[model samples]
Structures are given as C-alpha cells and as structure tokens.
Target: MDTLEKEDLARYNRQIILPELGITGQEKLKGAKVLVIGAGGLGCPALQYLVGAGVGFIGIVEDDVVELSNLHRQVLYGIADIGRSKALAASEKLSLLNPLIQIISYQQRLVPENAEMLFSGYDLVLDGSDNFETRFLVNDTCVLLNMPFVFGAVFRFDGQVSVFNYEGGPVYRDVFPEAPSEDQRPNCEDSGVLGMLPGVIGSYMAAEAIKMITGIGTPLSGRLLVIDLLDNSSQVFMIAGANPDLKKDKEKSGTEEAYAINLEQFKRLSDLHAQRVCVIDVREVYEFEELPTLALNIPLYELLTAQLPLDKILVFICQSGSRSRMAVQVLKGHYKGEMYSLGTLLFK
Candidate 1:
C-alpha cells in the first residue's frame, strides 16, 4: 500500500481523527478494491459513498443506458448522460469525484459465463441488481469464489440489507432459499419504489462495505436489516441455518451442468421430438390458468417432493428462469430422461 500523501491526509482528515478510524483505517479504505453490480437506484448512492470514502480501485458493471425514468433515483447521471452507457457514465462521474482512485467500467451484462472471471479481480462485490436471476447468479458465483458481498434490495417503501459469504458467514442462499414466483414479488416497475428508498438502503450497503474493509464495526453477517421508510420502522432479524438440500442442489448443478433451451430451440424440439418430449409448467396452478399454455401444471414445491414419471424428455417452464433452474436441480438424478429449463423463454 502506498503512503497517504498530504492531499490524502487533508481530504480524509475528518475520518482520520476518529478513534476507530485513524491513519491505518484510512489506508485500508484507500487500498480496497470493490465492485458494484448495477448503475441504477441503489448502485448510484452506493457508488457515491464508496468513491467519496476513497476506495482505491472500483469497478462498475452495468449493461443499461440512462433513461428518463431512471433520473428520479439514479442520482449519479444527468440529462446530458441520457441514452449513454450507464457503466461509462457512472465511471466518468466517479472519476471526477475522486481523481486519485482507479475506476473501471464494464458495459456488459453480468452473465454466468463472465461472472467468475470478473469477480476474481475484485476483493469484494456489492450487489444492487433488481432481478432474481442476476441476484441468484451473483450469490452462487460469490459462494464458489469464497468472496464476501454486501447485498441490498429495495421494494416500494421497504428495503433490506445484509452481508453474505464473508468469513464463514451466511450467504444470500441462506437467507432466501428460493426466489418467490414472479407474481408473488413484483419489480420496481410493477410495484413502484419510492425514490429515496434506494438512497437509504444504498448508504447502509456502502457503510457495510467500508466496515468490512476497515474492520472497524460488526458487519451484518448473521443478521438481516429490514427497514420500512413508510413508517420509519426498522428491525434486525437473525438468519437461521441454511437449507442443506439447496446447498447440495447447487453443488450438484455445478457439476452436472444444467441444460438450458431457448425459445427457438424449444420450438424446434417440440415440433421435431413431440413424441418424446413433455413440457411441464413448474409454476403455480393459478399462473398456468392465467397463461393457459398447452403444458401440464406441476408447482415447483410439489415437484421437489413428489415423484414423477421419467419416461419422456422433460422441459421445465416457469415465470422467469430461477424456479425452472431450481426444478432442474430437484429432478436431476431422479429422472433419467433428458432435462431442460425453458428459463425466461416462457415470457417471450
């Protein structure tokens, strides 16, 4: 680590004066490398604080571009940045905020193929993604890499924060064994989130990151912090033991490589191999009734416990891809037939 220069001392003097955070803590903050997963609501505030705190190296991974709707909460970008790549815009603003630190921008979506390689470069990850697929992927990758991450989620007037996969701590899987079905939990677009909710939640996430880096405070490793800005009420809940079955499933899926089929491939397979293939909708009965597809209905929870005939090729479909992926894990070895997850193709 390089010595703190006169400018650094002057810039960080307020924090340096604290008994908990002196020159040593300041140096730790300056040497840390952190990666943020989104450039939207929560990511905006988290990035602001992380840069303001002088984190030495920061990486932003965002595939989206700035839009008019995002201007309300994504405080980092302006009208001039509209239609520009979010990662590039965020990196440019953060660079202007702290010229001494290094900022790297990845203007591509974080996918399973590229996740491990990108996460390997950063010391810690901060996830602010809005969807379950990305969140679960981030969690699984972090668990595989043995890296710690600060997780934050905002829904309407409520938000939750926690630290996962740090020093034998509980991971995101420990807290959320399986993602809720699509209709159960709507996104910000559908449910609507207060503009300031992300700011509050994101600040907490940034504070946790700093705490993890400097070792000054107790991190939210075994506990989850839930706050409701609507009523200004807060509670901290202790996370219980993780699901051993889920852990086993994750490990098995990693080894066997769960097969995925897109819409076109699924269509061709259905047309060509109709005699051998059986499409199973793993969503709830209500969801199946609403969508009314030709596939048979088998709720994912029941599929996990019930035995099914494995005589034909099985393809699982759900609202998004997360449940189908979980369903694939449940039926991997029990069913000898070829298995595939429709993933997000059901929506398409």
Candidate 2:
C-alpha cells in the first residue's frame, strides 16, 4: 500500500487504523458523492459525520429557512442563523468542518419535475425530510431514477430507518407504497417530537450511507428498524418485496373534502349558511376561549373516541389547520361530510 498523504492520514486517523476501512476504504469515501435531501434535524447529523469522515462531494437540497423552533435538534445552526436558508447554512458549515470535501447546495424544494435529473447525479441520496408529501415525492422520484436512498423518520419518541433501492433490492414504495392521507398525518410541529429522536435516526442514516458506499456489513435492505426511546423497546421486521407500482393507478390526488380553506372563506361561510354543514373546531378549549367560533367544539381526542355526526358537511377548524386534518379521518368514517380545514383562517 502507498504511504498516506499527511492531511489524509491526519483527517481519518481513527478510521484508517481500522482493519476494515484502512486507507483504501478511506479513499473510497473521499471519492464518493452523496446528496442529502432536507437540511433540517436529520440532515444535520448525516452531513456532519459524512463530511467529517471525508465524503468527497456532498450535495444538500433544502429550500426552507432556519427558524427559532429548529434549534432544538438541527444542531448545524445557531440562533443567529434564523431567517437564513437551511441548505446554504448547512453547506457553509460543512465546508468549514472539512475543506477537503466539496459541499454543493441546492437551496430549493425537490419537485416531481426536477427530482429525476438532480437525483441522477449522486451515488446515494439520504432522506431526512419531515412530511409524508416530501417522503412520497422523494421515494417515488428515486424509483423512477433507479437510485438508492437511506430513509429515516422521527415521530414523537419513536424513529425508523432503512435503506431503499439497493442492489436491485426493494425500494421505499415496496414497503410503504402509499402515504397516509392528509387527514391521517400529524407533523412534529403540532404532534410533537422528543429532541434527541432526530439526532439518533439521522446519525444512523449517515452510518448506513457510509456502509453502503464502502461495502461494509449487511445494510438495512429488506428490513425495518424501529426505536422507541420512552418505552426502551426496539423492533425489527423482515419484509418481502412485492414490486408494486402505484403509477399503474396514476393521477392520484387528495380528496377535495379534505381541503382546508383559508380564513376568508371560513368568514364568508359564517355569513353564508349551510344548514347541513357542521363547522368543527379542533383547537383546545383554551385557544377557543380567545376567538370562539360557532363551529362545534370537539377536541381531536373527543372526535376520535365518540361517534361523529358525519352526515353534515364538516368544516374542520383549528389553531392552524394541522389538528383539524386529523379529525377529518374519523369523521370520514361516520359521515361523508365535505371536510374543509380552516387553517387558512390565520392571524384573524
């Protein structure tokens, strides 16, 4: 083996000493190109360790701005970075951590239109995006592109990680072919997540990415790992691939009844009456105290436990629109009401 260069030797001293990595694996890492989608909590650790370990080319794609709320687990930015672009901030920080590695930043949301072209350029894609919409978008785009991606998600104290589309193995869609409808989904913002959950899951994704690149131990293909911190329990399930393609039933879209109208429309509805339409308010009792509406005051939990009067056209309203969306699912079963979430009724 050739003698290691000074900087190479110093940068990867620990990894170099390992019999598995040696200098050759280190070089493989140096030559690899990785694209991480979404530079939020999950993106932070994935990028940090990848750059620290000498991934030669790293691309970050995120169009979101840093917010005060992100400081809990993003770990890449400080309070000073609030209002800045997330991808740009992550790229600059990763650049400083290891100048030897080149950081590429795509400060834009990955859409169906651009996903195929952009994902084709990288050896591996890492998914740390928060919502089901983005997850479905990224996973489907990966399928069309035939590229492999590491997937991670944190919900409350629970997290899951797995590798998708490897060595002709199963893709994400093979496991979760469909996303939960908007009414069934809950975001971290309202539903809540423990601070360390994202860190653990994101770091696991980085490790898997490194292993996949260097051809190390058996990766998490055809398997799912779920971790629950509060309960201190972990579950692993072996799954079979069915190769289902949702495009066969393409042109899929969410129901109009699940649509959340803006506040103006809600106000206009106040004047215009629908005797059969029931306005459902999901905000907690405390919030309703401030700007009370005539909508039926049903907390999300109450709506779930008790039977719903779904026969009426239901207009779901919340502090924003998140909780109200959850209510629509339960109401859908009881009645085929036209569900509209009044999250658009903001700041008024």
Candidate 3:
C-alpha cells in the first residue's frame, strides 16, 4: 500500500480510476508478485500490460533466444535482437517501459523440478508457454502448491484461456486429464498462428491476472473461454471437475534437476548412425515437400490423435526443434515413451 508513490499514480492513471481498481486496488497490484512463463508471442503482451499497469515485482521464466522468425509475433523484440536471449530482451524492454517496477529475468528453461519451487514464490503464474510438457508440469506443480495461475494458449486462428489452481477452484489437470497423444496435438511453429492472436489471448490473460490480484470481477475459474479470431466468434463453457488423477498426482519436485541438451550435445548425437534412431517429423504435410534423409512427417497438429506403433526409439523433428521439443512433452504426457528432439538438426 505504501509503495504507491505519486509517480506510480501518474503512470497508471487510467486504470487506477476504475471503480474496481481504484487507488486501493492499484495498491494491491503494486504489492502483487506475478511470474510469466515463456516470453514469446503471448508473454509479450501479458508482461507488457502487467508492467505498464504497475505490478511491483514481475518474474519472467524463459529459455529461448530471439531469431528472425520470432519477430513476427514477439512484439517486444526487433531485428536488432536477432541473437539475444528472449527473457533478457523482454526484461530490458519492460524496464524501459516502467522502471518503477521490478523485473527478474531467468534465462533458463522450466522443467518439472524447478517449476514447483518457482510457483511458490509468486502470487500468480501466467502460463504463456507453447509446449504441452511445460504446460502439464506447470499444472501439476501449481496444483500441488495451490497457486493461482492464468492459462492462455493459441494455435492458428483459435485460442483458449482459463484460470487454474485458484483458491477453491479446479486445476488444469481437472480439465485436461491427459495430454493429446501423438496425432492430436500441434505446435505453433508447425501450425502457423496469426500474429495478433497471442496479443488477443495474452491481453486477456493479463486482465485476468490483474483481476485475481486486485480481487475484481469474477475470473475464469471452472469455465473455459474459447476465441476464434477468424470469425470473431467466442464461446464460454463450464468445465466440471471429475478427474481423480488430478488429485492423486501428489508428487513434488524437490530440487530435482531436469535434463536438457545444448548446441554441442545436439550436434554430437547426429554423428551416430542415423538408422539406429527413428525420426518422427511433426511438421505438416505440405511442409514435407522438401523432405530430408530418414525424416518422417507427423506434422505437429496430428499428434495425440495419431497412434504410434511403439516399435522403435523415436526422435521427434520439427523446424528449429521448438515444436518437436514440445511434441516430446505431449507424447510423454499420454504415454511413457522414450523420445528426444534433434533441435535444428537439418542445418548442420
């Protein structure tokens, strides 16, 4: 409450005047601590509005670097940031926008082990993450910690938003009990998304987070909001809590380290005999026109719905390896299958 100085009031004048979010509510916002996972398309707007609105402490957890392709949707970055770390770039931009706020950027990936511990520190966690593995891990960990998190996801022209693990509310595991197997899931890199879609969805997430922090109007707990940008159609549905497994998943990640590969390790693996490992291509049909040696096209969107024979060791493949890395997570969601990704394997 004491943190709201004259500068803060001047900066957030518009929002502070709202009946629901007056000086007192804005004070609550100033006192709140929020963590946003993934600093890409969705994270850009979510973090922007939250920072511009004057949240005192904001934490960004991302393990990605900027590239030429990401500039389309990730508004916080630019051509000058072609090779900089995403979390750093995002924080730097946020700092320029509002120096009164605190921004902590962790330039590392989130895994099952670290996710839970991080969730405990923040008042709310907004998942702007793209992959299913991190999504599931966030849901499970937050559910265990009883944290309030705003969830937003986008694909092509469609997007979905929900609030999970809020006080006295249902968690995401309750809504999505299992990950969409191989054929059912798709990633943004392979599916193609409208740049503004994340802006639309992410802004909603920021609004939800602000409400949760300020105790404003009802949030999206126990309800799902689906938006289609193409037709400007929106639908709201009630999601009942029926999955007992969501409650049964009581495990906690107590400093357990998650495994990840760096550029060198990724290269070393390719030197091995390619035939020994089966490569699963998650790119769509048309993208496969220029096929590579020993590559199978699964096209990310078709995962979870497609049945895999479970015949051999599978190495998921996608452009730049981001989508396939996410695919491995989704596959791990439904089945205990052995899988890995050849991140950007084609370049070398």
- TM-score winner: 1
TM-score of 1: 0.70
| Colliding pairs, model 1 | none
Error of 3 at 6 (Å): 1.0
- TM-score, predicted candidate 3 vs. hidden true structure: 0.69
| Ranked by TM-score, top first | 1, 3, 2
Comparing 2 and 3 on TM-score, the stronger one: 3
Residue 313's lDDT in candidate 1: 83
In order, the Cα lDDT scores of the candidates are 0.84, 0.77, 0.78
**Which residue ranges in model 2 land beyond 4 Å of their true spot?**
1-4, 242-348
Per-residue lDDT of model 1, residues 215-318, tens digit only: 99899986678787987877665554333555577687775344767888888988988888877888766567766667777976466445666677888887
- TM-score, every prediction: 0.70, 0.68, 0.69
lDDT of 3 by residue, 1-348 (tens): 646888888888999889878999999999989999999999999999999988899999998999999988888899999899999999999999999989999888999768776777888899999878888988887777778899999989988899988877878766555565555476777879999999999999999999899899999987678788987877655553322343344234432113235556545655664445566777656445544435777755456667774755567765555556556645665645557766554532
Model 1 off-target regions past 4 Å?
A: 242-348
Candidate 2 lDDT over residue span 93-121, tens digit each: 88888988898899889888788877887
Q: Which residues of candidate 3, in runs, are more than 4 Å off?
A: 242-348
Ranking by lDDT: 1, 3, 2
The window of 10 residues in a row where model 3 has the poorest summed lDDT is 250-259
